[model samples]
Target: MAERLIPRQALEYIKNKKLRPAFSYKDVWNEEHAAAFTVAKTMQIDVLSDIKKAVEKAIENGTTFEQFKKELKPALMQKGWWGNKEMSDPLTGETVTAQLGSDRRLKTIYSTNLRSAYQKGQYDRTMESDLHPYLMYRIGPSLRHREQHLRWNNLIRPKDDPIWNSIFPPNGYGCKCYTVAVTEARKQKYERDGVPAYNPDTRKTVRLPVQTEAPKPSYRSYFNERKGTLERIPEGITPGFNWNQGQSGRTIPVLQECLKKAQNEMPEAVDSVIRTLQNSTIYRDQLSDFVDQAYKHKIDGKANYKNTAPVGFLDKKLTEFLKTEGIETSGRNLIVLEERLILNGKYSGRHTDDGNAPIQQDWKNLMDYLADSPVYWDSRQKKKNLLFLKKITESRYLKIAVDVLSTERYLKLPKVDTMYYLNIATENEIGISEYNEIMKLKKIR
Candidate 1:
């Protein structure tokens, strides 16, 4: 019962809730060791010397050796001590001799040296004068038993309670761990002395004792590791350097069928869009104000008005306004904002009256408000408009779909539409024609 229940019961009885079972002596020693290393190095004193002095002082202050070991857990952890293997008697499996802590192993040797120095204590006190007491004071807490508990508390969680589950596994006696101290300076020294050096002037070199040849990586591994994420690929192809190229293709008839469906659906779509536009009070007013401004620009063209007409002037002005609103302006004359505002998992697209991308569906929503909304026109007229609008819409959606499919293997195809859109076009050809009397609708791109 004591193995499990005693720890919990004793911990509960202790006034300091932090005195728990899981927080073991090893943990305390580790923290103190770390604190000692930090404080000693920060003071720029020899760490080993400061540690010995601090230990002697603690012993004089009446700290039992066993209790000192328990408290030194934190410092040991900080100092980076790693306990070496133990040598045991083969017959009994009991170790007769063990090299434990550095202090434990060196205690006898240190005593012999101290005794030799004792005779010269008054005549030549090297130990007393050489030891830095002030620097030791800074790291004093890390060297003492109570200071060990303080550091352990700082490291372990739930400072007010013991966490028994976190304890290290118990092992044979004298198998205590230790820490090792290593600095960047030491590493640099090792690099300088350990590595072979070559003299370029003499064309001679010294070889290292332990030589190593780095493994050569495969071509595939090298290519993958050095590949750029954003590199562009050929049309209808995704950017991948794999042997088998990725391609995107759909049956030509399927594309034609999708085209037909897009046309069939546009009358209702356009009518719906026009209604929304007519109903928007703010949008209607904004559109009117922009058209008026563009018309003014057309009149100012005067002698140059031959190329610049009122309709052309309105497209550019409206497009500029759209740009200010964060709508992507791709082509000079084409303004496409293919965003859907979702409501209850159902979406309605907004587009311009002519079936272009910018027409807000709100215009068609105003169809009830406007009695003559082309949406309410005869089915024959609506069908004609739908066919034209479908042609344009399918062209745009095709570009998107083709680009997506191009990433798959074996579906590669030429992106004729994508290239057409990518070509350079003069202002008039692309839709930025100056305000003129003979306003003509630009060709579908």
Candidate 2:
């Protein structure tokens, strides 16, 4: 039997020149949520081919559809059976990338709706409508990822990290990972019941709820094993050695040691110190102490201090350096901003966080020490590179496509196979009422 290509119904996909069947796998294989499609009458044949496989698997198990449902409920705990219904791609032997919890009748109904749209040119936009089209497009693959990660995706330990050492090795490289696609309607059904609408191929009315956002990977989770070693440093040493004005220099390598210890044990305290150092007065005081301690300057009493040139100008110089890097001015808001930036890069694409900022060599040394310690071991290194690329590409593509599709010049044509072709239809916005009116004209049952 020949393989079947289950195409999407969105006109944007059908009429898209960039999404030819030849290149459709690019969309299929990526984390990006764009669907590949084309409009034609025979496409339903493809869906039937897919259905035939599900039926065949049922028959192979010596059960009819009715019998399979009962057996499947228990058998779903088995490796091959994921949910009440078993799904697979006959061509590649890959699992179907739809939510397992969706209405089983939805696929049959959606098929009917498409048949109607093909013949009568109308149906509830909510029923196999563009809204549902995009909604399924997002959530179908989301289920795929959640399943893959929980079942298939493995964590690899870094060579230097002991905790993840046994977690498994990394992907060879260029691994194409798929994540969950989420949308409002699918969410409602999932919440009301424990099941998600896994069958995007199905078309039935399932209540929609607001989308559940995917959870983000946190720094702590990534580097949990290293947290233990990073907390030993004292606060004073983390800043650096400092001496009084015009007095004999004091030695304070212990201060540097203290800072190093706090890197893991006390990040909040570390941050506090950084902020304190940002103040010109505190920075100068600390610098003077550091210089005096290092034998670079002499600290004296108030009279000597007044007569002497300003101590430690390095603090102001360091502040300017930090600004050139991604660090923002010190404040509560900026601190939160820094945290977000450090983890996810700039909230908006236009800016980055303070991780890029230049710091005093002492600060750098302390960070390097922390990096060596277990606490900061799982800090941003490998994943940051991947995340940076993912953010840029996904944001750019979605924005561009939506901007084009919502424009008037892209008026849709009623094409075969429930697809939209670019034609002479009015380019006016297809309002919710207009969509409903079109459905009413078709007399959807």
Candidate 3:
């Protein structure tokens, strides 16, 4: 039979996984496997990379298990990683005999990695789908199955159901189980007619009514020898397999770590890192998504808004300049607080009425304005603010106000009080005078 084609989503999922070298599978741990690719006893980066590359190729080409083993066995044998070997345990710093590579190990690695990648990809696609909001658990083709898995087969639940978080497929080593998304119409049909069952005579699945309410979970205490902890894992799931891969795989905490590191570096290095981050597609996409979500929350009448995204860092020159003016920066990064943007009832309303309030598109350009525009000290206010002005045309400009004093009084860091457009052409005398005063203040870039 021709091999089934792999989904592009599945391919992308595997392609994007970060390589993590680990002495034991437990080193990487549960949902972390979704984002990090690892293999037990693979401590060397080169060996791990080799294994990951082969896996990637297998997934991309739909290579059979035998074919994968055949392609990889020679490389492993040549690299001295193919048989039982004596190696030092990184955790205990002791020499121990460990299984390195063999046919059985190769098969398990190949199957587990491929299954996880496909499952995670499917989960992401299912969550994003509006039409097919229900998920039905299906048992994979195998001679025998776990009793609990058999009981859970054909169980229908909403995509957001917490049950999937604990029980979404591949529940154990060599446990062939998966989920399929179905529409409400199909679910209704299942209710009226039946759930799907296989007809051996027709060689096709047929509808049956065997599916029922989602089963309540039963837990078992499994002592994890590697971690040396007794943990409660859902009964059907393998000790290290109880997590929603798709949900956990999407996080990018590495970016935040990088930002934190940048905060402590020299001024030039921090500025360079900030500039690179601002120009990155990932950062831009994250900022845009936050703005869109904030807008949705505002219109939806949600309160106690606490979401925030870092827009840019302060220039040290500006920090020192503020210090001279008796304003302390406290060495904190400036952020665009969601509450300040959407929940400042009257303040937001006034800007909206004046045609100066920042629209969704303006938020996208904020990082660029913060990084590249001329920053001026607003000396008129009791609590001096930093003004970032980017000229849009001859008379129109984009203005972003960063309230420095709020850091000392109410906030953890300096924040943008308001972002709006300024049109000098249409400004009243008072407004023009204020603009002139700002232009005369020291320009720190």
Clashing residue pairs in all predictions, respectively, total 56, 37, 2
lDDT of 1 by residue, 1-445 (tens): 0111122212211111111111112222221221121221111233344345434433334344554555554465465432443445333456543333355633432332222122112112211233311100001112233322222221212111112111111111121211112234433443456524464567788533211211221222212222222332222111121111000011122223322343356633533443343354433333343334334443554222111110011123333443554543222221111111111012122222223222223322222222221111112221211001111232221011112112222222211111111011224432223111112322222
lDDT of 3 by residue, 10-100 (tens): 7777776767888877777675575578888887788888898898999889999999989888988888887888988888899989899
Query: Which model, 2 or 3, shows the larger lDDT?
Result: 3
Give candidates' CA RMSD values in order. Answer: 31.4, 30.2, 14.7
Residue-wise C-alpha lDDT for candidate 2, range 335-409, written one tens digit per residue: 000111112212122221312221233221221221121110111222100000001122110000001011122
Q: Candidate 3: minimum summed lDDT over ten consecutive residues — where? A: 248-257
Q: Please give the lDDT score for candidate 3.
A: 0.74
* Candidate with the greatest TM-score versus the true structure: 3
Report the C-alpha displacement of residue 58, candidate 3, in angstroms.
Answer: 1.0
After superposing candidate 3 on the true structure, give the runs of residues whose Cα lies further than 4 Å from its correct spot. Answer: 1-3, 199-207, 210-212, 223-230, 249-445
- TM-scores for every candidate against the unseen true structure: 0.13, 0.16, 0.58
Candidate that would win on lDDT: 3
